[model samples]
Target: MPPLPSHEYHVGIICALHIEMAAMRAMLDEEHGTFSKKAIHDHNTYFGGQIHNHNVVIACLPAGIDGVVAAGTVAKDMSRTFEQLRFGLLVGTGAGIPNLEAGVDVRLGDVVVSRPSGVYGGVVQYYRGKSKAGGMWEPKGMLNAPPVVLLTALQSLQAEYELEDSRMPSYLAKMLERRPKMRSMGYARPEMDKDVLYLAAYHHVVGRTTCDACEVAQTLARPPRVSTDPQIHYGVIASGDRVVNDAVTRDRLRQDYGALCVEMEAAGLMNDFPCLVIRGICGYADSHKNENWRRYGAATAAAYAKELLLHASIEETSQEKPVQQILGKSSETTRSEQDWAEQFFSKKQVTFQ
Candidate 1:
């Protein structure tokens, strides 16, 4: 069969980092290769393929360009060319807010999904606001939510999880079996001992790249679980332009927004493109953070995203509204109109859920 046209691709997955894209790409059941771009201005490098019954096109932000602004540009360019994106999955690594007393003890390599836990609708941009006084109005990433088809799928998957654990382990194992070299790059789960949570006040020794130089005595103690399998949690995810590398900021965001995870790019996608953010916990949002678990973190989140897609029926996905229509335009919309603020604010019910 011929490769699918960009219009036929119903799902779009955006990753801000290369490891995130690599892990997501490995989850594809069939690699369809890139289709011809309909717009020359859409600079995103597309990796088209199928995930179960859905045609998923995955793209990563261009090299060294990250944060909210870069993410919005990538999503806008992608939507223009693909034309039929029902919704997006922003899969990547994020700084986790570990709150043991809150039952949201997010640990390294685990996955945290965006789901409505309060008024925030799963993902909220804490700094985003209409008023010039940034603190007065939270960024509007709060205004959008994953579409109904995806929410329905999320609910179904959550219900299934109550009966059994997530299928991420099986999926991750399969992905590694297909791409064995990923194991060398740390895609496989690290030893339980390495998954340490340090004290909030304890800063890593300056100029040291890894935790090996840091004192383990300053770390927080917790009993180890019998199984080291990555757990999946659902709740509000805080989205902003800054990285939370200090315990003070991490604790503050959690207290203020009730966010379980923090990341840099979700705010960009949430305001314009409707998407679900899935992040693997690469480190505790603290001074001791390192890249040790990043590869595995990226893989676990990708695995959960793959599992979520399986729950969404292709028929329902097909019936959903195209992204262009949601943005108050059509696939043929001019490039200038595509990125305008008027087009986005014109639709009051952009969430479509």
Candidate 2:
């Protein structure tokens, strides 16, 4: 087909860490096609000439807010060149939230779309009078929140696999057992270490917070906020600058913040980007950071994101009548709002090897 409309195929795919990006490339290879790695950046890897007329731009930036901002900026810039840049998708892995159940672990592999409230710490500014002291809040104005359709796809995949076994590293698991107080707070029993929990949560939160750079004072100074209509889910993501291999810290974050997941990049990215945080439970907060489990979990979540993108692209292309009717009034509207089914079912056929 006439080189699938430029705007229809061009997408920005970003991974926060190297492993994440690698996994993403692997997935793309399976679905779209192989990606040839091009130049590298301080926070991203450029992959050009991919399948389906879609130029797959991949980035495995450093873990933190600075990395997110730098990568996002690059993605945004690269998007400008495309005649049809549909939307941006950040795919990869993350630490899962505790007490969320093994079933939900399927959701971990799904793509979590962050409908950004605004740029905060490093690049964008957060709105004023919108957040409380201990917790983060959404911004006001024309909110062009990023899409979350990606997560839906992952959820579908999770259902398909019916994979229930969740695990972490052995050393990490032992760490959590040492902290009784943390365990009481709902942090899973450690088969590993105690400090990992605290460090992961701390860094995850701090990094996300700092990256958004939600300078309330600065945002308040600006004019009315421009809101875009996009689907998004809001929740807390735990962070720590260090790799959390402890149970105590993990429980502390769950008890204190009711966080949904823990990861190195969210805190960093959240600090700068006003977006919803979704995490796949790779392993319970412990030294038992199971590498295989982590990879599968991350892939599961990322797969979900890909499915969502496919649906979204279809929606955008088809221009479902209801959506058209809703936004028909204003061409100036930056985004169109549509209700996406929260729970998704997988259609992929499974075969026993």
Q: Rate the local accuracy (lDDT) of all candidates.
A: 0.80, 0.37
Candidate 1 residue-wise lDDT, 20-101, digit = tens: 9999999988998866655778888989899998999999999988877788888888888989988899999998997877
In candidate 1 the C-alpha lDDT for residue 139 amounts to 42
For candidate 2, write residues 1-353 as lDDT tens digits: 11223343445565665555554554452233323332233223355334333444445564554333354454433444332444445555555444433222212222233333224211111111143355533333232333344334434444544563222222223324443443343333223221122223222223442213333332111122132111122244544334444554555444544544555444333322222333434555543334444554444444444434443444543332221122212212122110110110011111110
Question: What's the lDDT for candidate 1?
Answer: 0.80
Q: Per-residue error at 229 for model 2, in Å?
A: 33
Top candidate by TM-score:
1
Relative to the unseen true structure, what is the C-alpha lDDT of residue 63 in candidate 1, on a scale of 0 to 100? 95
RMSD of each: 7.0, 17.2
Worst 10 residues of 2 by lDDT: 337-346
lDDT of 2 at 297: 48
Sequence-dependent TM-score of model 1 = 0.88
Instruction: Please give the lDDT score at residue 251 for candidate 2.
Output: 50
